[model samples]
Target: MSARDGLDADERHLLVVDDDDRIRDLLKKYLSRAGFRVTAAADAGQARKLMSMLDFDLMILDVMMPGEDGFSLTKSIRARPGRQTPVLILTARGLPDDRIEGLALGADDYLAKPFEPQELLLRVEAILRRAGPRPVVQRRLSLGPCTFDVERGELSRDGKPVRITEAEAQLLRTLAKAAHAPVDRLALAPDATDATGRAVDVQVTRLRRKIEADPKNPRYLQTVRGVGYMLAPDE
Candidate 1:
């Protein structure tokens, strides 16, 4: 297997929301190098925006921020519809009640500040392992005017070949394999080095432009809130 295959075999995507620039940057760098995809946000506002666009396997939230603290944010995320992406709250305050509150609000785990990076990594791995593996996917898909062959990694629209970049082809194949199921952005990444899953997002946009009548409001290539992209092929 290649190095990328060995490193973060699952390619889980993580979101780190913290007001502390130093902390956020450190976590992003550390997590990225460790083989997992990481995205950082300065505050709840930025986190919400990121969450709206990308699907994350886990979220690391710093409990104290200027607006909408981690606790409140966690509550809001759980209240939202669809999959509740696992949340790991980080706080300087190590109070038992704080941990209880976070858990009650739907957080999967809690880590106090000044934690060892290794411990955090281990916790993340444990949480994901518990989240379970993605379901098996179908081999073929029908997307309105488009038909995708997962094994061949080919897409055709209206009985005509629709040219796609190698990157787009790979992404389509991944999504096709998991048709009707949410595929995490990181899992669809062309390579392991795409730690932020930004490359995957770009490819999805291009694919939507070609497949959807209106890319802005996609029907087949849909975003599963708090999860990732799902290909809703015709039955």
Candidate 2:
């Protein structure tokens, strides 16, 4: 429950993106009281604007938006470079297939509409724990021109903070620990969820944007084709 100021840089900043005003306000208030710097977005457009304007540690996106649904938006983020933030999909769909679709689009977690706030808090905390950013990094790691601090989950270049998606942070931590070993797509799925192979591919695509200088021909995070995915040498 720590923050960047008094706590650590590893503290999480949350964005709650939903079309429903009541849900958004409630989540923002509740998450704030739980020690998160939260922002709200009514739709994909506003979420895009907020993304353009600020950095969020994690994003909670509603699947049923007006134009750009959460899946579509997740696809857009996956397509871009330097934006690998972690995403959690919130929807009424409890179907495994529906959850798979959201995960395939690069969402890290999924929760149904009638979910408990405490459970939501737990999920949020779990995602943040993966990245471990906010307070400060205890160790320093070098990745090409950029650097990642595993303990703090912060990535920086030349002493300047570089914005990375929460997904990116999670990937970096995962790959960093594995070093040169390849991490399977299934290995990246949310702890308690059953995710399909397609879902893993989406997460990898989104992660490449933040980690690879050339997402098309990634050097650091690489694909093993049939074998699965692995982290290229950090150097």
Candidate 3:
């Protein structure tokens, strides 16, 4: 039986960042065969650029790159505001301290060089499994006095229809879909050409005004520090 027998390879995308072209290509080919869409970056700079534009299910990073090593890259990634994509550190440094540091820096797993391809595939699968599936968005969400119907992208306050722009409705639906989980600002403004997430911030502010009793201190549309915004619905 094939390792990827029942897996949906087309859905999960992986980013492989390594300085060595040979190892990077080999890993990409092997993982692709194992049922995953793969993209490769030669260094942290390239990896960062790719991350800004595309979302990846997981990252395979080499720890010994020339500029901004894997450890540093991992730290920066964790510190940044947005999705905390799972990372697996692949490196020649197999020492105890190295592994400890990688985990401490928020890496999902650590694998030393001279490792078997089968072992690597297993580790990748394990990490993806641990990350779990995406949260299922409820059709209806309660935000204090305001209730949102995700299916219709409609918001009502105290059983009365609330006036909202199409843009606001779209934003609210996006937030409601993630309900309680932080939705990346970029993800919120999928149509906006602006990459700074300013458009998302504006939309959130507008949505909060309608749904929050105190827009100054939002209760439902809450900001996630160093991440994005989360929709905390009333139970």
Candidate 4:
């Protein structure tokens, strides 16, 4: 698969979760054409059902659902062994806290509402490349005043222990890997689903609440406008 919009196009399986049929079907078609096998869910509950029924290489989860939102489902999936399956979160709230929240939830990446499909493709490729067993330094990161240990699945500061929800850890890990460079918002989206850059922005903002000392003028996570996300992997 060729890389475009700074997103990669590796062939893979993707699961999309959203309440809206238009978004779900649109993503299913877009991702499929992008060289991925796509499955879809209307909400977290449906996503859970699909998870129980089948295996997907990647998942795209919607944050606001009727019940059992994306964050909840991500936590549940994080519990299973080797279920470290990558996830790209979807949300309408672009607040920093919300972005941080999704990262804290174990999502591989995220996308905000009103995003471009081409951007989503790029984001998917970035995640897929980083996940591969290459010597590339895409998966380790540092947040201000703290360290996010992706391999061990832990977040800490000054060697002090911090409790991270499984979902949060996943988000942190995803950003951490791309700490060396600015990971585009599109690259942080679900491989199987389509969402906007604004949504990814929200998830990043939420992650800051847990890592950065100040969410505003963040010291660790920084935004690269018209591009994607940049994580300061170390102090």
Candidate with best TM-score: 1
Q: Per-residue CA lDDT of candidate 3, range 123-168, in tens? A: 9888877777633457778888888887677889999999887777
The sequence of per-residue lDDT tens digits that candidate 1 reaches over residues 90-147 is 9998999999999999999999988998888878877777777633345668889898
Better of 1 and 2 by TM-score: 1
| Deviation in Å, model 1, residue 73 alpha carbon | 1.0
What CA root-mean-square deviation does each model show from the true structure? Answer: 9.7, 10.5, 7.2, 14.9
Native-vs-model 3 lDDT? 0.84
Q: Each model's TM-score? A: 0.61, 0.55, 0.60, 0.53
Over all chains combined, what TM-score does candidate 4 have?
A: 0.53
**Which digits, one per residue and each the tens of the lDDT, describe model 2 over residues 1-235?**
5443343433567888999999999999988887778889999888875564456788999998898898898777665443378889998878899899989888899999899998998888777777655533236677666678766668886778878766656656666555666656654543315566676677678766766688999887788776567765545
Q: By TM-score, how accurate is candidate 1?
A: 0.61
lDDT of 4 by residue, 1-235 (tens): 4443333344366899999899999999998887677888888766764554344667888888887788888886775533367888877877889888888978888899989998887787778777763233333355656776667768777779887665455555556654546655654543325566566666777778877778898777788777777777554
Error of 4 at 234 (Å): 44
Position 109, candidate 4: lDDT = 87
